[model samples]
Target chain A: MEISSKLLEKAVAEMSQLPGIGKRTALRLVLHLLRQPVSQTDSLAQALQELRTRIRHCRECHNISDSDLCEICNSSRRDRSLVCVVEDIRDVMAIENTGHFRGLYHVLGGKISPMEGVGPQDLTIASLVEKVRGGEVRELIFALSATMEGDTTNFYIYRQLEGLPVTLSTIARGVPVGDELEYADEVTLGRSILQRIPFEGSLNR
Target chain B: MEISSKLLEKAVAEMSQLPGIGKRTALRLVLHLLRQPVSQTDSLAQALQELRTRIRHCRECHNISDSDLCEICNSSRRDRSLVCVVEDIRDVMAIENTGHFRGLYHVLGGKISPMEGVGPQDLTIASLVEKVRGGEVRELIFALSATMEGDTTNFYIYRQLEGLPVTLSTIARGVPVGDELEYADEVTLGRSILQRIPFEGSLNR
Candidate 1:
């Protein structure tokens, strides 16, 4: 009954530290990995090892990149004047997947959250201000989560760029696609109510 | 949009191979790893690499172990004469968690399935027969899945040990605790019917 083995215990402990994984789940994941072919596990190991060593933050906008500048920042085909500001590199990828937005991106690394002891100085706000000060940017879209902390961070950024030429805006929040009103959470319902729009063609009809 | 980054793509692709995970989940896991401190990702990579290089199969029962013998096999307190035959190491863990079983185990790796081309020769059944014939074992318990393939494999093994003096039996099957009949699937219902137990007391009384 006792897991006396050092290697197995160590692997389980490591897996338990991952998000949403417990000790039992960690054991299952470790044992599953142990059963798979050695080559498949080796590939995962190599990928994880290279994730930190090979990847770097884009020098201009702090997006994840293997080179000095990220692919989005380096592309001349993108709308250089319009930049979408996000909380992390993952948001950058999500925006990139929507082929409609042909604009540049600025990754803020994280949002300002006083409860978590995170402040504007701890993030890439200075770099963003510097980018805005350069006078090439037109519109700055804030595509952050609709949490209170996210809003606080967005407001802080907006105040920091006061009198700057960039027009700041945020993504609309409402019921998600394929979801009905019955399942929508209270906060989403409230926000959708507050931001309700007038029907356009129906007014004329 | 195309996944322009090779390293990110590689990491996501490798992660997607895990059970119950798809491309989107792989991307989420990769992005989560990317956001973490470099040391955390390094630890995961090191653990994954060590899992392959450090863990080895037990020579006796084919269970995963860091040494020549597994923890269960090496324990002196367990009943060595009562061997519980299982389909994989997962079943061994499940029975061990109950803390009722005080016996040894033999992992058959997989069940006999002619549809997928797996046969008796591909299993550890021959070694099991040899272990029983060695005169140390007294009883051989079949603790396999309740699937048709599992039943077929159990019958095939029973035929192999027909002349042996060892006792053979299976675990009980019926309605699970805290489960409703409405949620029960057809296979479980059929199994419950076939393996029904006699009434301990008259419900009418």
Candidate 2:
């Protein structure tokens, strides 16, 4: 749409460059900023600039961090011998929120998606393999999403650490915790039944 | 959501401060920015700051502008004697896109909403009344949205200009051009029937 002010139009254009945000939404958001005090916009701009320019990725896990190492990697409490592989730090946050997993994380940056031109080489898979070769990690758990890309990345990584002493396993594929059995998707239900755990093991959890 | 980096968390918090964006969406958007080149985030921050700090409002109509006067108010082609009163510049953009109205606009910034603690004094109502008293505008068209707050703002303005020589009118309310009559809301359909125009006049348009 044609905007009256060139500066406003530029701001809207920049805002809409983000995924899922349209020109109309960008205009609304920009107008909202205009209505708010200038300090709000200033802080927002400052924060974004600081994040993009000053942010560092953990040298070990590749998760976004304030310093060379992320808190998880720096923490002595977390199990260094157990690694959970994920697509990005978002998955790290999700799994961390669960308060169940005590393992350290291996952020892959993203999955191998041929459609998007992302390859296994684009991720931190090489470092993960090296870590496994270093003999500290006893088990590597694949915690990526249940998408085709996630499966491909898992298989690719599994092949990379082929015949290594370290064990490789994937997170369970099943109907979610709160979902009804009948209402679950066919493949998910089928997988749930096929991967059913022992009765005693389920009760223990 | 628990973010790894302080800078990342700050960025997400700032992004979620925007209207309609939740914490999850904010994290996703912020991560998307991190994946892109630093230049993109830099430009976005620059554009927002420029818009917020340098943008001006038209002295006459209070519409956002690059200079003292907006394009519509500065142009000689638009009818200065005919003014369309709208809630904000978004409405101006919508009407301008239609290319039907040749009149100038008076942006009220926002409507009167008691629920939000917004009153007439919070908007540009005083300037609008003064504009009417200036004796330049011969007709005022109310182009505000069909909402209780819009009606209140319109009525409040109408009262302010009561007994003035200028004429006041509201845009037509009926079934939208492409909408089916059978599916229209009851009040809208009832109003459409009650305000039926001359069949030949409709054909001429």
Candidate 3:
């Protein structure tokens, strides 16, 4: 609150500007840094500075990278023909950690949130459509979040590729793998039943 | 978890090394920074670097400062004969926020904790003894935490100042203001009862 040092106050103010960090937590963190070796703060500052200055986005999918093309887009082992669309790089990382999909990703940067003034133009929708029109992607999978904004973005993109030759698909919506049916939301449970897959087909996944 | 970019991974690693931050929270913060303007990140990094590089400690009290003497030590209004000894600058800030103390502070940097390999030699105990020996401070107030380590540090300092011509006292322990009696811990309640002061003294405070 009443910090004695101007330098400490400035550092705390800057740190509290970050999302989810409050003034007290920021003070605790700044105090912790003060107790640590100067090299720790030097490395932390260097990492953050480099992240902002040198970070790049893949020209194809718009995922964060250090070079023009991201690692996923440049990999030959991934299925370039199958593109899974996501809201941001966090989603890409989440999907990649599952190890279930071999397809490459197309990061849209964010969903179509009209309330937040983020429209289709604010995202990478146009570039994604261009990628599909290049004829290399045989299937474009909609893997966005299951929110209204996610659905709107998917529909908007689907309309843009209406007459295209590429096949369109979306990830299955159902109760999660380890979740109890009773605990699942009504909409998800109903959708799971309505779009139930064949017993033999489910065995493979 | 499975971050694709090396720079992103490095930044997340450094950010998560802070107290109470985890990998997921670190990723969330890093992504939030990526979404913000580059100037925001630049300022945050610059502030942290400057705090580590340019901050100074007061020669008299050891509180963090921008010059040789801290604001408290430089102030002529503060009582020169009374000193409140604390564990660190955080305590100094906390006490200053209360706006009740008008005495100078002596920061010990840390309390004595033998289990953590911290001893009297690791703290500013020698400097504190020297201050008392200088004969300007007529009273020494112990304002350290009410923990075993804090008490040990206080007792150690009391022994060091046994023959000095100075009055020594510790802060009162009691049910905090606005706290319910039923909720007060036994140790504090017992101490409050044992060290009961005059009823008129309570009315004045």
Clashing residue pairs, candidate 1?
A: none
Error of 1 at B5 (Å): 3.0
True contacts kept of 3: 0.90
lDDT of 2 by residue, A1-205 (tens): 8887899999999999999999999999999999899999999999999999999999999888999999999999999999999998888999999888999999999999999999878989999999999999999999989989988998999889999998888888888887788899999999989999877755536
Worst 10 residues of 3 chain A by lDDT: A196-205
CAPRI verdict (incorrect, acceptable, medium, high) for model 2:
high
- In model 1, the runs with Cα more than 4 Å from the true position are A1-5, A174-205, B1-4, B177-205
Preferred candidate (lDDT higher): 2 or 3: 3
Worst 10 residues of 2 chain A by lDDT: A196-205
Return the candidate ranking by lDDT, descending: 3, 2, 1
Q: Which candidate is the best by TM-score?
A: 3
In angstroms and one decimal each, the interface RMSD of every candidate reads 2.3, 0.7, 0.8
> Tens digit of lDDT per residue, candidate 1, span A89-149?
7788778777768988888888999999999998999989999999999999999888898
Off by over 4 Å in 3: A201-205, B201-205
CA displacement after TM-score superposition, residue B130 of candidate 1 (Å): 0.3
DockQ of each: 0.48, 0.88, 0.85
Top model by DockQ, which number? 2
Could you tell me the C-alpha RMSD of candidate 1 in Å?
A: 4.3
Per-model TM-score versus the true fold: 0.87, 0.95, 0.96
lDDT of each: 0.84, 0.93, 0.93
- Residues A1-205, candidate 3, lDDT per residue (tens digit)? 7887889899999999999999999999998998899999999999998998899999989999999999999998999899999998888998999999998899999999989999999999999999999999999999999999999999999999999999989999999988999999999999999999878755646
Alpha-carbon deviation at A161 in model 3, angstroms: 1.0
